[model samples]
Target: MTRNNYAPYITISREEWAKRSDDPMLHLLNDFETLQGLNEPLTMEEITQIYVPLSRLLNLYVSGAQRLHAATNSFLGSQFLKVPFIIGIAGSVAVGKSTTARVLQRLLSAWPNHPKVDLVTTDGFLYPNKVLEQKGIMNRKGFPESYDIRRLIQFLANVKSAKERVSAPVYSHLEYDILPNELKWIESPDIVIVEGVNVLQVRPRQQQKEPTIFVSDFFDFSIFVDAEMEDLQQWYIDRFKSLRQTAFRNPESYFHRYAHLSDKESEVIATNIWNEINRPNLELNILPTRFRASLILEKGGHHFVQSLKLRRI
Candidate 1:
């Protein structure tokens, strides 16, 4: 495929990017299996070839941000607290973003200068089932309107301002809802990763006049995991099948009923969900923000990152 010459990003083959890094940090490979998401393949070779260099690049950005912070403090002649460097990871569901975020958290934290890297997913910010039902948007669960946007912005603002303690609502995949009175507390971290499908999305202008902020406003760097539409649809269906055998089998799981369906029946339901819900969200909401990312990880058919795109500064 020919490069889009007018694009703001510099596209490079994975091999070309891998040439810049020689240190694989192989000791970290042991954690890969645990961190990887279902149906996501993350071999040590892939980590060394792709993520090693990516980690180095992130470290550079973190260092530069810290330097700029210190310089700004000096210029103002005021002692300002150091805020965490925030990275936003965005992509469609079942595109391996969770694995990417977890891998980055592990790799970035390995750096001695930034030992306290914390990861949080935007799933926590999604509105509860009751709230969605009240709004009559239960079918649009992953859509932008299904989120508590104002609260998400406030949470990021607190993180960017270096708040002593910031808390986020906890979401449970098994329960498929927000857990009441459960919160994830984040202390002062050197870096914070906010991962979700809609992290790169810009709010619709019709929603509010003169909106003050967006979820991405606080991101120092952002990444979009990209793949062909067909690949994503297939992955989503495959993931559903896998979950039916695993999490969906749990008596308390919200999707427990799905486990009882025949293989063909499950496939039909999964395909319908993908075509009606997830596919439209990807086309209308998520993919539009792909170019807005600082970097894009373009995946091939086997879910391997085939290329990298870094937005020109």
Candidate 2:
């Protein structure tokens, strides 16, 4: 795989970016009460200091995209396309991309201009367990090949092409499988957040001929949530231990077998899984795509975003 140069980005410290108040929208973090103390327990200061600015930035992008779409329509003399500004968020397992996405969803929706913001995770795009088993890639679940890329592309295409409604499969974390009977429907949204481990990935040149389309091709903006490999492993193990007593206790859960595991046993198992599956996937597929992001959020020891690098316009 070819590496991308980071020369396009300008690094900004948490303290510095937090002080930016050129936009009036940056002061609206006080209304975002629902996002406080999520599963990761984001601090109030973090919300004000980090994500407020990010929400404003995304709003600007969404507004610009809306204007461009309208201009194109005027030039073509037709109300043709209704493209939702698509935002892609990528990261390794347990790197808090979901938290960033959920926060952004809440914050962005608060803006009156883009009240209809929807978030779709790529986990829902993963092939069903039965299908993965048939393909002999069940062990490779969460890797890029485990996903139904063509279907995902079609779903995005439908959403971007002003389809009245489009549906995507839903994945159950407790069941560790795609719910065969369930689907999440997306209607007309002003902005869409596509969050996943593989959203930014590109097939290696050696793997096949360069495709005419990629999942990232649909994105107007993208973010990569980054942390050290060791930190990610620790976070994964911690979450596993927490889930052992909660989600794993459900008899219907595929991970129910881990319900009885002691903290030590859970730690050992999670660490092993990290080393075997998640680590390799991060190194080979996920991490390599980091520079492809429009912005990179670099997190510290406790999952706090310490700084960010934004691609210069």
Q: Write the per-residue lDDT of candidate 1 for residues 150-219, one digit (tens) a residue.
A: 8999999999899989999999999999998999999999999999999988856575768567888899
RMSD of every prediction: 2.7, 3.6
The per-model lDDT (C-alpha) reads 0.92, 0.87
Among all candidates shown, the one with the greatest lDDT: 1
> How much lDDT does candidate 2 score?
0.87
For model 2, where is the 10-residue window of minimal lDDT? Answer: 32-41
True lDDT of residue 35, candidate 2: 55
- TM-scores of the candidates are 0.96, 0.91
Off by over 4 Å in 2: 1-6, 21-39, 204-211
Q: Per-residue lDDT of 126-160 in model 2, one digit per residue for the tens? A: 99999999999998999989999999999988987
